[model samples]
Target: MPAHIGRPVIRLAAHRVTTDALLDHIAATCRDADDPTKPHPRLGLWKRLIRNTGVEQRYWTRPLQEATAPSSVGHRAGVAFGDALDLAESAARDALDVAGLDPGDVDAIVTSHTTSWTVPGMDVHLIERLGLRPTVTRIGLSTLACVGGAQSLVHALWHTLARPGARVLVVVAETLSTIYHESETTPQSMMYRALFGDSAGAAVVTGLTDETSADLPTGFVALDPLELVMPNSRDRYWGTIDDEGLHFDSTRKAAAAATDAVPYITDWLGKRRPEWAIVHPGGPRIIDDVVTSIGLAEKAGRYSHASLAENGNLGGTAVLDVLARTHDDPPAPGSPGALIAFGPGFTAAGVYGAWI
Candidate 1:
């Protein structure tokens, strides 16, 4: 039986920072404030990279001024994880409510979080907070980054396929703002600092049943899922930790990483042209390259662009936010569509499905 996905629910951090505000914050915090007349030696490059990220505004877990303040790793971890959990729980509750399911009705949970590391992680906390069964099956992904949403959905599909009638809760949350510290000054780090935001998203996937089939929400019916890793591409993007906090590092090759994966994805998709596309809003170039390469209409990428402009890159939560927007402007019933996301490890995850 094919698993059915519910419309996703997205929750963002409380603080909204516009591009101008973020630039101001960075100049004040990262550059030498002693002399207002002199910009940091690298300020020009940072501005160029940040301007190209395609983010107009983004939400942060804390005030923009305080987000990049110097702090111990342990303190950062606590704040980021706590805030992310708050968003995650809210998103999860709303997701289940929309699907007409109680917490106890969830047979399994799939979560992806990479912002802050903690023992027992988000799964254990969510099980307690959401009152899910103690014995519920769970998969916690810690390093998938931007691909988390699509990859978690793939796991949900697998669970439902193996355990018919089971319902799997998919949650992806990230406090990427926690990693935006003054210590990270590399070009790639600066770009990431500007590109990321904080958000949590959740969706429900269930195998069709005689009882549940009639109640299934109008959304995607999961078909084939693809997981791909480009050979010799591990260094394109990666994570590192220092005394200050976690940092994302990337080489120049990272810019073309998504474009390089197009052939593999198109092969997996065969000749089917998707009527709709849920492209991860990683950056404008990534979205443009994928949509054009895969033969999707220019409008197919609007949801992704809109998400990026409104919320920045939500890391692991981005794909779900885009999916949520797709739900708002739904396609024709039973039309074929595709969902794809890219992340560190030069990894790509995708699902070919149809509107229901």
Candidate 2:
């Protein structure tokens, strides 16, 4: 299909929580209450994991006390949904402003999230809250994990391609911290606790026929979006819902899986190498592996590193956060850029875009 997607304009909204504060909170809460002789078994490992996450701070939807408190799944779900709605609305409004459009102008809405689940989903709430047309086409993607943001844009691109002149708003909002609990001390849980945060991002995508097309805006024009799901890799990384709440499990080989998939991605990209790369900051290891596997220059991972260090992982919104950073200090005009994100199903979603 022709490149009908317009420049994607994004807005990121985050909560407040520094890495130091969160670590301290964890240490305090995880201490053994009955046995002074036995410190938390994972204390040492937690410290190391937090330090290695390349994260200095991250935001949360709930206050520190509430987030760290032991809460039921029901309670957490309620809080997360409320917070997501507010953040999503704010992000969508800002993105619309940047695109110089109004809610009524949007023909479709694609919402992506992984932190919370709701019956009507975020799409319905967003429409009611943002005053968007009730008849607007809506797509709600709750699963896709970290790749949700990029996938939402890809879906928006298809929407615009199918219906010329359609204005699609893509919103990815995640409040991962709301699910954190001090009681869960598994290594994987600790790693997630240290690395995940609450954030929401929105982007506007439309069709453009030429560089001078009236629909073109001061944003990155998406092109050649692609997605790949590794075969038989569904068990590599996934989440489960238990009585306590949602639990994420990833084998130590998660990064290796991503690295191994790079060659296939390169083959898919053919000869196109983006000058700028906006990759999901899956972590320090995954970022390094991607840079090496794709043969991208080390500098190409700068934005991804900065996003990881500053905001940790925003789950579904991480890629959009990186994209927003590029918007503030964009690459050379017309420079090709790559947007990539990884998630459950051991999937990789990518797109090649050019700065407008």
**Clash pairs of candidate 1?**
none
Give me the runs in candidate 1 sitting further than 4 Å from their true place. 32-37
Write model 1 residue lDDT over 17-63, tens digit each, in one string: 89888888777766555876777778888888899999999999899
Give the TM-score (vs. native) of candidate 1: 0.97
- Can you give the lDDT of residue 218 in candidate 2? 59
Q: What's the distance in Å from true for residue 61, model 2? A: 1.3
Which candidate leads the pack in lDDT?
A: 1
Over 128-182, each residue of candidate 2 has an lDDT whose tens digit, in order, gives 9899999999999988879998899888888878886678898988877865767
RMSD of 1: 1.4
Which candidate tops TM-score? 1
Q: After superposition, how far is residue 348 of candidate 2 from its true place, in Å?
A: 1.4
